[model samples]
Target: MFTQDSKRALTAAALILATLTCGCAFESSPRGELGADQDLLKTCDPAAPPASFVQIDGTGSSNSDAIAAERMTAVEAIARRTAVCSGYLRVTVFSSSSAATAVLFDGALKMDGATENARLKRVPEAVSDVMNKVRSAYAPAVQALPQSGSDITAQLRLAAEWKQQLGGNYCLDLTVFSDGFQNIGVDLGARALSRQEAERLAEQPAVPKLAGASVVVAGLGRVAEGAPPSAVVEGLVSYYTKLCQRTEASSCTAVSDYATATR
Candidate 1:
């Protein structure tokens, strides 16, 4: 038997507790938080918007002698920053001899708002893990792959295929770390394309099937043994740019430095 005033106070306390519990549950619910996170990502620049699928192409330029630490760091940043929660990252290293691609990080990464810093910090470590695996296991297993030289078109096609298999709404980000000299599977015959020839060829339509995904072509100007000349790099950039344009990519550009490009 409680006094009326005492009962009223208890009722008020109950209501307050219920309200707080509901609020906390909403904030912690996976669906509720995902919606909130997506809203935050919308504020990002359209050019640098969050990604649904990020594919890293590690070919001759990325794994071989041309592998530049600076460029790799930049690429790692792009892959990490663009990766949104519930997205996927696929890293592939290919040579004429063999190829290997793996999902380095998969699932929701919580790319909204304050999580950006955490995501950024996570990217470098993720890249290191992937690269370590590449150097140790992937490279060794594929050592006998029989070097056919660099076959870039095939790599892009593979990336597109992997993205398509996801089978849903996704913003694709394709980052190619390469020296931009593709010869093995190119139609120009066994000989690499000269800068002049590459320019003329780049004018032709070479659209990828990644739908509306954007592309970032970095490390395009590196030179290595059997790599394309510096002039060829310029032509390759133009070629990829045209390809991206024809495919209606969100954005596409060849960056000299990954760090500078992202900034």
Candidate 2:
């Protein structure tokens, strides 16, 4: 034990043993604290990310500076939320004809893999880019308001179709920014529609099947110029609720303000 060579040999052996032990521990305990931190770094659910669709009513009644401002705020919130989860976002403008409906922005919110702190730092910048694009696309899309009529039902159908086409185990979220005025086929503004009537209308074949989807009809009965009476607003809410239910959606929320419609 007193020999210098023996001491050095023992030191080397100990070092090798330590190295092997550490390697074995790392291989066997891949789910340890450090590994868990790496796992937690991924903020988005890779298997079932949310697929969000926003439909803006580009009709005469819904066009206003105030409404546009509110929409921008709502869209920013939505874009931030979606970006945080690395989900999908689609913005569309709907008017009289579904055929004439325009998709302003359709893309995914993507983030790079990094440490939690790094991810947090990068999130805002990523979200800002997305919101900028959304705003740019939305402005021109809604500038020319349609005067023919509002085809709200057709918008729902289009969303359903888009969801089907985007096949995945995605959580569907549909947000419609509208005044809840249906003038295409069924006139929701003629008179206050009864719940029974709404039920019947929802049951029609024209209604899209949106099973397992979450639906939010924001700014319901909130027109730019003339606000509908309370009774009419109530009727609009009932109609949308029944419509969503008839489509077999998991949840339905029809609110007067876009801010209140957030999940």
The candidate that wins on TM-score is: 2
lDDT of 2 by residue, 1-263 (tens): 34653453344323221221101101112565334324433434566676878888888787888778777766765665566556788988888877867787788776666655555456678767876877787767776646788888888899899899888777677888889885477777877777777667656636888877777777778787877887777778888778777788877777665552111
Residue 31 miss distance in model 2 (angstroms):
28
The local distance difference test score of each candidate is 0.48, 0.68
Off by over 4 Å in 1: 1-68, 83-86, 97-138, 141-144, 185-199, 203-206, 225-230, 256-263
Report the Cα lDDT for residue 64, model 1: 51
User: What value does the lDDT take at residue 138 in candidate 2?
Assistant: 76
Model 1: residue 99 alpha-carbon error in angstroms: 6.9
Worst 10 residues of 2 by lDDT: 20-29
State the displacement of the C-alpha of residue 193, model 2, in Å, after optimal TM-score superposition: 2.5
